[model samples]
Target: MKKAVLILSIICMIFIFVQSWFLSLGGSYFDFATMFQGGIVGKILALLFIAGGIAIMFKPQVAMVVYFLGGAAGVLASMFIEYQDLFLWGIVALVLGLMSYLFNREEKEGKPGSNL
Candidate 1:
């Protein structure tokens, strides 16, 4: 489960980075102005996702917080930019964040052997 979450985080971050890059390059599928203007926020969000993914590797607890915050930001940014795809990424980030929190909690509680 931890591995799955980690992989998902990495993949999502990569997608976000690529999307940000595309937007920065003036590539648009629907609304160009929205994407271009939102690209700055998108770049920041991408960095957060990348940081969260890296943190997940060394510190699951910290990564949990990062993911949660990043997810919330992603959702809000998506709404502001009127981009639907970012909402999905936000959902994924939230789920993975919750999973990481649960796993960390379990480890702290000493309920299991702790794979994370």
Candidate 2:
């Protein structure tokens, strides 16, 4: 489960980065500018997500906060922007974020009897 979340995070981050870059280059392949409210903000969000992905790979506990916030922000942003596609991705991110948080919590608490 942890592996799956990690993979999903990485994939999502890559997609965000590429999409942002495309927007930066004046490419409207995904209409992210309209979805994000502007090209600059979209690029910034992508950069932040890239950072969040790196944090998830290294410090997952800390990254959990980022994931939750990002997920919520993505959902809200999508809705307000009226972008159905982003809303779906937002849902995906939210689920992956929750899974990652749960996996990290389990790791921290450890399995029963493991101390023995």
Candidate 3:
């Protein structure tokens, strides 16, 4: 389960880049400006998602908080940008949150460095 969520997180980040490329080429069905404005907050949130996914590998507990925060930001972004249906964005957040919740388990050793 942990591995699965890690994979999904990677996929989501890739999709974000792909979607940006699609908009650049004017090949997407949705409006780019409304969703991909490259605003300060959006970029920060994007970075947060990437960072959260990376951190998940080393520390699942801390990663869960990052994932939850990222999911919340995504949902908020959906509300501000209505180019695509909010339901889809909500689903993405829901999946991230669910996966994080399902896969999180305490490491046997303290903080991965105490003892065997």
Best by TM-score: 1
Which model scores highest in lDDT? 1
lDDT tens readout by residue for model 3, 1-116: 66666677677766655554444345234545664443333445446556667776777666677767766766676677632433343356456666665556445443575464
- Name the regions of candidate 2 deviating beyond 4 angstroms: 23-41, 111-116
Off by over 4 Å in 3: 24-46, 83-90, 106-116
- Candidate order (lDDT): 1, 2, 3
Off by over 4 Å in 1: 27-32, 111-116
TM-score of each: 0.78, 0.66, 0.62
What TM-score does model 2 achieve against the real structure?
Answer: 0.66
Candidate 1, pairs of clashing residues = none
lDDT of each: 0.75, 0.62, 0.58
Judged by TM-score relative to the true structure, which candidate is superior, 2 or 3? 2
CA error at residue 65 for candidate 2, angstroms: 0.8
Across 71-91, the per-residue lDDT of candidate 1 in tens digits comes to 897788888884556777777
Judge candidate 2 at residue 76 and give its lDDT.
76
| Candidate 3 accuracy as lDDT | 0.58
What is the C-alpha RMSD, rounded to one decimal, of candidate 1? 4.1
